[model samples]
Target: MLNGLGVWDIFLTLTTLTRGYLIWKVVNLLTRSTTGSTNVYQEICGQWVQTNTLTMDNADWGTFVRYAHRVKSIVIHNDSLFGNCKTIDVSILRALSMPPIPPASILFPQLRQLVCYDRRDEIYPFVRLLFGPKLTKVDVRLEASRSAQLAVLPSLAAWCPSVKKAELRVWRERPLGAGGINEVRALSDVVCKWRHLEQLSCGVGCLDDKAILHLGKLNSLRSLQLRISSHLTYHSVRQAEHGPLFQFLDHIHMVAIDSLSSCTSFFPLFSSLPPNITISPYAPYRSEGLCDLFTDLSVHESSGVLEDVSVEDHFQSTAPEEVFTIETLRPLLGLHRLRILSLETFYSFSLDDNALKEIGSAFPLLAELSLTADRGSNRHSKISVNGLITLLGLCPHLTSLSLTIDATRVDDIEPERRPGGGISNLNIDTLRLNDSKINHPRIVAAILFDVLPYVDVFAWEWGAHFDESDAEIYRPRWVEVQALLGAFRTVQEWRQPGFLPM
Candidate 1:
């Protein structure tokens, strides 16, 4: 067992063991030095700390004062921990009451962005400190309180003079012209005084004639977002005529605005302005000429002011054929500058070739498109994937597409089950299809072969009967589908490492 003598062999074995221990000690010392140079917790903790954001509900007055001194921005949202009240009790009030904290500058010298819930009018004086020359943005939500000091507008404007940009949602509209004139005058003064004011967004609880008149006086404003109910009448239109409201607008975002009856109502005033206008599909006003009153504005046809448009329509107790027709989408197709288009709550009158063609050609610059059909109580006609492929042919530049089809009908006791045949023609990189009733390997294979011949990635939701384990058995079918398109031979090209089993 030894090279020459047993004692020599034992000495050699002991020498090797001692060398191994020395190597282990050197590795441990090297690891310690590396760790000392980099501490992961410091990076993580530093990321969590912000210059000036506080959970006022969870923080005390002393804590707020300490952080408020460095805070340049503050955002306070309704939190369950804070008792979920619309209004938060600012620690600033408590701090102000305490042993005359050195001047407010000592407590909050750089705080600028203040976002608060509409608590009451009495909080105005306390808020004034945060709205000095340093303030740039203010977001406040208003609630109805009859006895609050801020029950009127003049008091609010007078309390805060340095608000440059403001977003307010009030419980009721301020009276304009004669009755709300004093409040309007105060607002006018505030607007005039804030030379740097650029954006004003207001959601009125009640938009009356006087309110529109008061809003017309904001000539210096560059961007305006208004949300008012459909109750605004022709009388209110008369009030908007006294002063030009849309003259200086370069950008406009409108929501829940049902009162604007037609382009004639507001566009005539802004004849000289070339503004990028956007209207949320939830707006109440239904366009009289918008293809059978579907309540959508066609950006292609409209002076290109509304560049991107999304349509959401709901039909009441009517058949899909009766609700949506080729004529219904005429206004949408007319939109010119539409680069992104999404149609939700789509009710097709019929899945005819003409209907598909009209929709496909509606948006030329569209790179992303989503069409969602509603699954209502009434039965809906099934749409073939081939029809979608045909649509893709019309939209040549499309890179991403989403289609949600619901073919379930109430009358049928048993639905006919058929394989999903592949779609041919057209080139698209990304596709999402939601089908609940489809699941034949041959059917899926045939469909994928026809559509995604060169597709690198494929994402599909399994039909109702499939689960995780079934994917292994059905995976061969997927391979078959790709094989038909010559994709199987190039297996290395496809990389979907973790697919949810069929």
Candidate 2:
């Protein structure tokens, strides 16, 4: 028996020693590979090349150029690198320069996309270099001087015949005289020539009904986004108005309209939109107009085909305003096929238990729902624990949810009747509580866990005015709730083999 025990001890010692040696060798090998100039090329060869300026000496420049073909993307702020290489094979390039490199020096044979934000004087030369057949995408934002010449869109079309996507923004350095309707006509003429272009975004301060009609002729266009000056008007409701622009929207799958004016009218045009389409409007409209817009959408036959709806007040403001009321949203409930709904407001929006119930009952197919207040805004949302429970019970198909509710009065309210009883199975994968004002986060977390025990991702943040010093008072309660949730998950996994807990 003593000899048998000695043999087992020897086996254990040998196994441990072998493992230690292997671990030591691995550590040494990793250390050597990561800690020297010899590995620099290996470290950066496959990565995106980012440089402030090309100030490296000849040796370093040569080394970078030798490995330039391995770079998939590069961003250069200065133009000094233009002369260092005869050829580069980057796929994407972004150059921010005051003066563009000479056209002759630009040599990116394999480039597919290019983004250049430079002065008007440099844009021509920079664009001339990117006029190859392989270039499919281009984004150019030019700063125009007082004497700056307008870039001819025809020239761009002639050079970039195979370009599929383009975004152009021209801003004058100083407030100059506005371009006339003639300029708009000229631009439309140039843009209509791109037969291969599938997507186009332009902010040229001269797009109107005529330009839109001209662009409608492009049979290959799948997506269109236009940023036009607010001064341009389209009176689609007028009896005398008849344009091909409305017909153009019928074939396009996605359209985004951005107007610089605080209030731009598109009601007349939107009424005739395609039944199956995605529309994003970045400009804010008047509250009354917005209500009218929703009412119109609800009654339209195309409302059933609407898949994504987002209303965000992009301007930063502190006080919540009454932008969207429960009554205004009541009409939107008719959109039964809606899958994604996002409404972020700067002002306090009224959302009661009844409204939540109506939403869940109306949009049974909703996969993502985000009802959040703008960041830094003070919100007084009227959502109780019972209301949230009702919503979860009704929306069984929901996978992602974001809610900003004022739960300060949760303790005062009675516990929900049949709390989490209706939910037989939970499909929720992500939940985010924005600026939770709940008296106890643990209680809220527990309530959520009871309904969505399998939720893979959970995030919560306190209200803007929450005091951190008082966290100690709530630490024990949070730990208790977490322990209960953990045990619940463990039991669930044990009962159902192969169950993954989050």
How do the predictions measure up, each by TM-score?
A: 0.57, 0.64
lDDT by residue (tens digit), candidate 2, 1-502: 1223332343343233222111100000111222343322211111123333323234433432332233222232323324432221121212312123322333444456666544335435435544455667767654433233244455566666677887765554332235554555545665666667777776533456645655555556656655433455654333344553343343222222343231224434543444333333344445565566567666764566576666654443443344456776777888888877776554445677777889999888888888765442224457776677778777777888877555554564336643456453377756565554546756665565777787533223443332344334443444454566676677867789776656
Per-residue lDDT of model 1, residues 1-502, tens digit only: 2123233333333223222111100000111123356322110000111223222332344444543443466554443324533233344334333423434453445656677653555455555555544667777765434334234344435545566687765444432212133333333344444544568776433333444444455566677665433343335555444655556656665543343343334443443333355544333222233353333343222355544544554323243223344555666666655666665543423344456666777766677675544432012324454455557666766777765322222122112532223334345655554332234544444444455555532323432222445445444544454455454424534455654433
Clashes of each: 12, 2
| Model 1 weakest lDDT span, ten residues long | 21-30
TM-score between candidate 2 and the true structure: 0.64
Error of 2 at 113 (Å): 2.3
At residue 342, give the lDDT of candidate 2.
Answer: 75
Query: Which residue pairs in candidate 2 collide?
Result: 320-347, 321-347
